[model samples]
Target chain A: MDHYTLLNPLIGGILIGLASLLATVLSGKIPGISGVFGRLLVLATPDPPSVAAATYGVAGKTWRAVFLLGLIGGAALSFALWQSAAIFRPMRPLVVMAIAGLLVGFGTRLGGGCTSGHGVCGVGIGAKDSMAATLIFMATAMVTVFIYNRAIL
Target chain B: MKAGKLFLLLVAGGLFGCGLAISGMTDPARVIGFLDLLGAWDPALLFVMAGAVAVYGLGMLVLRRFASRNLKLPTASSSPIDRRLVIGAAIFGLGWGLGGFCPGPALANLGGLRAEALLFVPAMAIGMLLAQRFFGADS
Candidate 1:
């Protein structure tokens, strides 16, 4: 692999791992972004929460909101300071992104977690379900890519 | 709110975002570039995953040992591999392949004020709401 391909990605992955580990140690909470965001959405809804939502008290909600704000704010701060030129746009249409986003939001909740939660943190912790979920994620994503690129576009 | 915890949270979030940008997760094209197995497949993402998992695995092992020794580390529980997990993961994979933006990167990219993220994030929030409604209040 090229130097760029090897160094940045490897180091970046290490950083992500470290971050997740830190979150676990500091708060005893899994740093699953999808789960955190999903909780917020569920809480925000006007309708009464299910028994599960009721269990997620004000303290948990506060931390989650703080963590999310930190995520966005941190990214913005770094982007502004370092001004990384690596960002890209959607190759697909706006409609595609929207639809995909919806699926991501819904599916992650249903699935219990996303890439960071399942693929990285879940697998690392020796969770059988996470391992299974990760395998399914990679397989289905490949199939989708094949269909989208070869058949559709 | 506890200042220390908040600061750590900020640091963790910062590290995660930096990792996403550095690992090229902020770039959907790069993500799609790897997913296109039939085409010119870039295996860089594999290295990213490997690098991440290796570090996390070591950390977890160490943490578990400490916890076993009476440290206050949080415990982890495993979910079941049932229909919800399978169907949900499948749907997520399809969406990921379709959009090239997962939850983390999508939110991180939104920090840059990307228009696509503006659309994706709100719709994603709505989708979460709808999903909870469908699955019942707790789901």
Candidate 2:
């Protein structure tokens, strides 16, 4: 764990927040990618709110497709840049990793928006729910880490 | 209008992804490893924030010139920063300190196809949903 590792959390947090704010100010969307995905998954149903009137009801299927595609495209672009420097570090046990993934997906649905939706977008505009969601989310995380290190580890 | 917004998002997303990658944020190992320092930690990530701010500031200035009076969004906003916020940021920080996965990176890492994030993300979502129901989401 050199320096870049630490930078990820703090700097990452700030950049993420900034990106979200800019996206909101410029595009009027909060950049809640996960929420976007959710709409995409459930787009089969007619969106209750009209697009112009509702602000963020259900987006068109085509737009969702493109949004999802942008996610992939962004990743690809980064991978292309970091292609060589990629450091495949030692991984947690596959079992552990898998469990973590399941937990995260479950948490996302339960939480409403992952960190981006609540923590960044929500917090940016001063949403009460985002704040509460982020608080509980963090508390649970802290307890889990403490347990993992002191007892589980 | 939707098309226009999508175009902007597409560009922003690309820039965001690039920022994460270039800032060395896409790699969780880097983050988890860094957390090894409970305190007396490096502020490298802070610099990343500064850089990103510079970029965002310039971007915002340019965007302001676009002269779009602005269309209202479906997304919710909270101006007061009430108890929920104080509590939420603390909780989010705790989770972040422990898991090294917050909102943006969680999504970006998912885009990178990291299997670990696959789990953390869902659990995170569930957590958010729980907040929405109990706390009453910003409808």
Candidate 3:
């Protein structure tokens, strides 16, 4: 705690806020990563025609794809510019990681949003559902971490 | 969509990724540390969320007044708190705690070429597909 610094996180958070703002203003879209990614998956895979229409339309696919590619490109650029921008530390085994991914994917879809969707953009707009979802997920995550630390670790 | 909108989307996505990287959210260890409430907790994430939410909240308020027509905002739903929301969030939280990665950070890490993300993203996609197919989850 003594060694913690606040400048970077603040700046980064502002950047994220600005990104969301831009997305909304320019494209009229909420930049929720899970929703964006999930819809893109629907487009790529052959699913029920109803599902495809219900989610992403043909016109919607290009922007989502470009946005995601930009996300990846931005991250790659950051890593290249700042070599220490990301340091990978494997906490759990590969199996655990895969399972975690599955849960995240399923849960976000089922729940209707992830941290970006609910936590940031949803909360930003003062949506009650987003607020409730955010609190529920945060509490559950904290409890899970507590159990993981005590029992798993 | 228009080329202009597409370009802006790209820029927005890039900014989002840069924010994640710069804020250290791309690191699962840092995320887990923040979540480890019982252990030595780091409040950096709180500040990040605060800063982001504050800006976004204000921005949306002003934007709605000026450009509501042009904006394709998410429609407000009338659904109440239900089992689907609770169960879904709980399941997502469990996975988040286990892996210490959310969708945003996980994808960003994949871009950074992290081996963990490589394994995680595919599984997440599969999970999303399953949820959509079997559970009729909304995308």
Candidate 4:
């Protein structure tokens, strides 16, 4: 019974959802992970509207730079606090990680935000859609894992 | 609208990321292990959660101090969750189970991890666009 973190996946999922909810409520914006990046990448386009819009709201580079900074800083800080365990877990080749990354981007866009968008924030706001989405995501994830455990990996 | 606000969003991202990292979320191995159960179930992921939940709960307390007609939001914007949500979630989960990647981690990976992200992130975006188009966000 190693209760080191004193937390489990179930609770972790719930907490993650809750944080998304809180952020959405506080900011008056949904905490959609991909959406945040999409906003960041607006500069990829030379289109005036995208550029203007990006300027109107949070400056694309500024926000994106901060976002990246936060991510890296957070990872590094966590590593510092908890050592390697906190920073990263063993991973496959860069190619494997890259493939996983792209699929997720597609999923977030197709699905509209990541788990945080639906699983946590939408849920907190009492949206029916979030609940359904969260359920599906969890079930699918479980099934996917079950399959991997049995068949693939 | 101004440099200041942009700064805030970045700060928020960093804060959020730091929180995620501190909770041991940056690593897919931990996430996968948690899902493994008998094979490699690590319950430590729970602390990452406890801290987050506590933060949210405390946030509510502090939020009340700033609560007004609009609360923390300049305008109380709300979206009603609906059927499309279920479909979106299912699609998202299918990807997650396949590769333990999510939007947050995906974006964070722009730092590196090229090929995996190139494929997955695009798929995720497609999923989101489909939702906005199909659902016609009302609000």
Taking the tens digit of each residue's C-alpha lDDT, what string does model 4 give over A20-47?
A: 4444453456656666655454433334
As a TM-score, model 3 comes out at: 0.92
**lDDT tens readout by residue for model 1, B1-139:** 4878878887888888878777777778878888888889977677778888888889988877766665465445644689988988898898899998889889988889998889999888887777777773232
lDDT of 2 by residue, B24-115 (tens): 55565554444444533445454554554444444444555564656344345444545544555555555554556555556666666666
lDDT (10s digit) by residue, model 2, range A29-122: 5556656554444422333455532433335555545544655566556666565213334235545554454445435544556555665556
lDDT of 3 by residue, B1-139 (tens): 7888789899999999988887778878778889999788977678778888999988888877786485666544565768888888888999998999999889998787888899999999999888877766463
What's model 4's lDDT at B126?
Answer: 56
Kindly state the number of residue pairs that clash in model 2: 56
| Tens-digit lDDT track of model 1 for A71-99 | 77666765665534245756889999999
**Descending-TM-score candidate ranking:** 3, 1, 4, 2
Q: What is the TM-score of chain B alone in each candidate?
A: 0.89, 0.75, 0.93, 0.74
- Point out where model 2 deviates above 4 Å: A1-18, A25-27, A43-59, A83-91, B1-4, B33-68, B73-107, B110-139
Flag regions of model 3 displaced more than 4 Å: A1-4, A43-55, B137-139
lDDT of 4 by residue, B1-139 (tens): 3666555655566566555544455566776666566566766545554444455445554565666756554121244454445555666676676676677665444434445445556655554444444443221
Deviation (Å) of A4 in candidate 1: 4.0
Pairs in clash, predicted candidate 3 = none
**Candidate number with the higher lDDT (1 or 2):** 1
- Where's the lowest-lDDT run of ten residues in candidate 4 chain B? B130-139
Each prediction's total of clashing residue pairs, residues at least 3 apart in sequence or on different chains, is: 0, 56, 0, 44
